[model samples]
Target chain A: MKRVAYPQMGNLGISVKSFLWELGAEPIEPSPISKRTMDLGVQNAPEFACLPLKVNLGNHLESIEKGAEYLLMAGGIGPCRFGYYGEVQREILQDLQKDAEMIVIEPNIFSIYWSFNYLHGGFVSPLRLYRILKFAMKKMKAIDDLERITQYLRPRAKKPQQVNLRYQKYLKLLDQAASEDRIKELKAEGIERLQELNNPEVKDVVHVGIVGEIYQVLEPYVSLNIEEKLGEMGVQVHRELFLSHWVMDHILKRVDRSSYINAATPYLGAMIGGHGQETVGQAVLYAREGLDGVIQLAPFTCMPEIVAESILPVVSEREQIPILSLFFDEHSGEAGVQTRIEAFVDLIKRRSERSVLA
Target chain B: MRGYLGIDVGSVSTNIVFTNEQMEVLDSLYIRTQGRPIDAVQRGMAQMYDKDGDLQILGVGTTGSGRHLIGAMVGADCIKNEITAHAVAASHLNPEVRTVLEIGGQDSKIILLRQGIVVDFAMNTVCAAGTGSFLDQQASRLGIPIEKFGELALQSQNPVRIAGRCSVFAESDMIHKQQMGHNTSDIIAGLCAALVRNYLNNVGKGKNIQEPVTFQGGVAANVGIRQAFEDALKVQVIVPEHYNVMGAIGCALLAREEVHNGEKSSKFKGFEMLDMEFQASSFECDGCPNHCEVINFKQNGKLIARWGARCPRWEVG
Candidate 1:
């Protein structure tokens, strides 16, 4: 087996690893993200960059350093920024003197031969590949479900330590479930273990709102499992941008405006450019909805989100919504990230205390 | 007489509309968001109060991305998406209208319809070059107020061609044309033409734009842009009288329809919500690889609603 490694999206490393392990292959860990890695990326890439590209660029460089034979990259061909990310990043990586087989998986209609060929080449036996995809989907769902249930329990736990114990127990079981050949057995055990976990209520916990790039928000490995650590500190976590909302906003409503524009109106008009509008809208929503504080995560040199970051201070000032912007590149230190989060939590707590005293 | 109130809160503006039992718009107010939606809403409500003395508000509906927050604040009976609200409003305005063109201060959208069903629509979220902001910037550069932009454009006998591909290109092209001795009226005309051109090339790309069309939002106020659009499409464009606050009007209509049908009591917090102090906060979850960032709500030091979590598994009563 040509065990290739690529820095996939956030939380993807572990999932890919588990998937690889199930395939009877040992997968190498993609190189960690670092400042130097991003610097190399920026040098090789275009001026207009999304956060995911910078992070992935650093990932590809790091993975090459780790002796990976091939780079696994997903391609999006759509109207969005994602469509051009793969090609741009690939050229950047190659220019920077990284030698690795770049496997670009293009997402397109079935008519696209490149997509068909890529899939056919990746898996030798069609039946086996079907089985693998099926298993991967189930495992992904289980892991997502497990994370969802445990995240809530940790915050509400009266005994913060108990929440950590339950969280760890569930995480282990989820990992085990992903690796299990008989997924049914793992599923049953996972559900039973989750139901049996003791959850206590933690009072006066700090609440923090997480908002940023879609991948950065969901992938635990990317954000360093920021949500779990917050729960361990007895902080309540509220994340903006749900998959459901994104789907409704992006997929469904995308066509909802078709009835409004015509020959007379001619142009379909332009978009609000960046998440600036959405961030402003969300910050106000958070303020009105009564969130304690907000943390915005964006990859270093991300244009759209940078616009949002600029306006967030105004949102914070006007709505009295405390918002912190965290820009991450491959070089972001775990300790530094944790310290900032800890301080933010402390700030919210002190603010809460002050509000009560007044 | 039973009535409904609708609130549409967008990034640049806040709109409030009132409708009678039959869902007919009685009055409305369009307030600049001015980066303070809460204050805008209060001011709008105060305006409504002044307009209609002792009109019983039976229900309230809120829409747009900020619908939930505003809905919660106003104790709304129904909270809906902008698409749904726009569709409802457009359908009511002209049942035969098959297409709706909404271009606001920051964003633009084209909604296609086949007999009142929203068959297809496209929204551009990543471009400002084709939006009203571009026009505002150009108006400033010309030392002309936005309100006077259309009038000046109408005076142009000859319109120059400015690059309509992007804001940067259009702006540089405009400055170059100005240096080349193009009259201000012609330049304004060229700017409007560029805006429409950019809109078509970018947002309206690959879409079939049909007729029975309605133009709306703040951008619709610019007659120069409307004429430019007409020149491009070679068709007559109809602008609704209440085009500026159609979203709010739509929500109010929806609310009226809901309440008249004996729906549950409106969730609107009432007029007193304008005075309440609310707090919001968020934290990260490191429990798993899915580092979910969650948000919560507090009113007067009491924890209220919490949202933004993928799994509602953490919510409490």
Candidate 2:
């Protein structure tokens, strides 16, 4: 079988893809998210569906039709719509009468044994899979490190072109290293290169925290590259949610109450019981850490974030922090976001000025 | 001599409540928004100013859907969500109260309180079967005024079951019972019962609804609905004194607290805000595919505030 694996972005997809590759399985390259993919997704998806669900479903469907037999994804159980997505996607594929096996790595609060067994069944030796995973994780960490380092340098780049060029070069190097045996060496070199590019001599700038849903947080096309736009405007960016943190918080830290409860006190109660709790905890931490402002981005129909958005005012009032909640659908625009960010930054600057006067 | 002004402009109605330095309700007005929040707010402000010309508005707190726009127009000291404003009002009135069942003109919300802190709450927005709008529509269709519908329901000897799963279902079911020759009182009481049942199933789902349960909002005035709720839940449903204007009262109380605590002078525009010309328009952001709807407010030909924006990209002048 000729295996053509798609480029994996985060922890879940990377883990699954690496495991499949280790088993001598062929994985077709998933299509890049484009207008055609989004249009197909919106047309097929249920009305009022969240953006992430539609996009991911569209990507999976496109890949499946391109002769990929195994379509892999994750599943959850909750009041949030995420828990039901896997089943809904399965039904949609079935309705389309696709022959691909929808491999769902079910995320349960209790065990990873089922996930391990499923992967092991495909592999001849579990130890070989373990070795592959070990290498994959190191590569993942390196990629994460390189991205974080770039965030620091990107804002201080004298011109927009400089930042864009540096980021593009680093991203290409990281992607090439993902499936290679010399992943560690490539990652280390990339990190060192990125670190060397950023210097403390660059002009100090105001930092803003971006917190919200996974899709809007990561997708530049959706958020209008608000981070890059902000950086171009001479503002440093601090994104609160990252793949590493999400893995640690949702996967490892969630294993026991003693592990995450103290650190995430507000989230300990009833899970809050979705991303609402997560968003609130992050907002509070962002404020307490003395970030200038926080921009919470979410889809328009999202329930958990809406609940968080409602209570965020009280948090803002108490902490004397300014948080802006931005909801995105297909209609969200760049100019609108720019206008709001400018106002927020202006507010922060003026507030600081008043404080200095006092 | 300074007074606090609290304005709650909901989708259906606009309310303005006034209080003295001591947080006493001095004057209040409730008017239907009638698809025009700007006009309703101006009219409400005009009435308040006319009623109390000499009152110096030291502070203003605005709440509800149009709070952001109205607050900016009036130079409000605080702009809060209806949930926070309502909770504050409920807590101030009866600090010991545990739950708030607020059924307004268009929506119904159940707020669960644990020692004055809101622990859990649910709002019924998708379905309007149990909201006051559904009830009003049914009453009007039956050729009975909403005010008398509750009274007519109270006279029913035996209540029938009206399917209140959805407003359309409830209306059809009500008509079916009426065609079967059920008395008007029975049909009206049946609606009251059906709405209570629907609310309990949806909004009160998985909730340990304890007392003292305070029912406030426009719908609280309906005695039949209260009786139906009481009979269904087997608990006493307490209605606050100012049921129709709790949101306004809460906002006023919040304003009073903000003014009393903050050292800076209030941002309130005094009574002259009643005559100010304000307009609001929204446009889609074209910078990205996200296309955020940015609502901008213009006062006297100058944009004062731009809200409903998700990102700060456009905030720069």
Point to the candidate with the largest DockQ.
2
Q: Mind giving the per-residue lDDT tens digits that candidate 1 earns over B1-317?
A: 46788899887889888877777878888888887776788888987776655767788888765676677667777776665677668888898887788888777877665566554455553467867777888888789999999989989999999987778988899999999999999988988888888887666655567788888888999999899989988878889998888988878877766766446576666666656777667886555433456667676678777765534345756
The native-contact fraction of candidate 1 is: 0.00
TM-score of 1: 0.61
Runs with alpha carbons beyond 4 Å of true place in candidate 2:
A1-55, A58-358, B261-263, B288-290
The weakest ten consecutive residues by lDDT in model 1 chain B span B307-316
Cα lDDT, model 1, residue A87 = 77
- Model 2 Cα displacement at A240 (Å)? 14
Residue-by-residue lDDT tens digits, candidate 1, A216-322: 77655556667877887677777645543443455335334332222102111333343434555555666767888888877666655666666666666667766
Model 1: runs farther than 4 Å from truth?
Answer: A1-5, A9-44, A47-55, A60-174, A177-184, A187-358, B51-53, B260-263
Top-scoring candidate (TM-score): 2
What lDDT tens digits, residue by residue, belong to model 2 across residues B121-172?
Answer: 5566356778888888888898998888888989999999898898898888
The complex in candidate 1 yields a DockQ of 0.01
Task: Supply every candidate's count of residue pairs whose N, Cα or C atoms clash at under 3 angstroms.
Answer: 65, 30
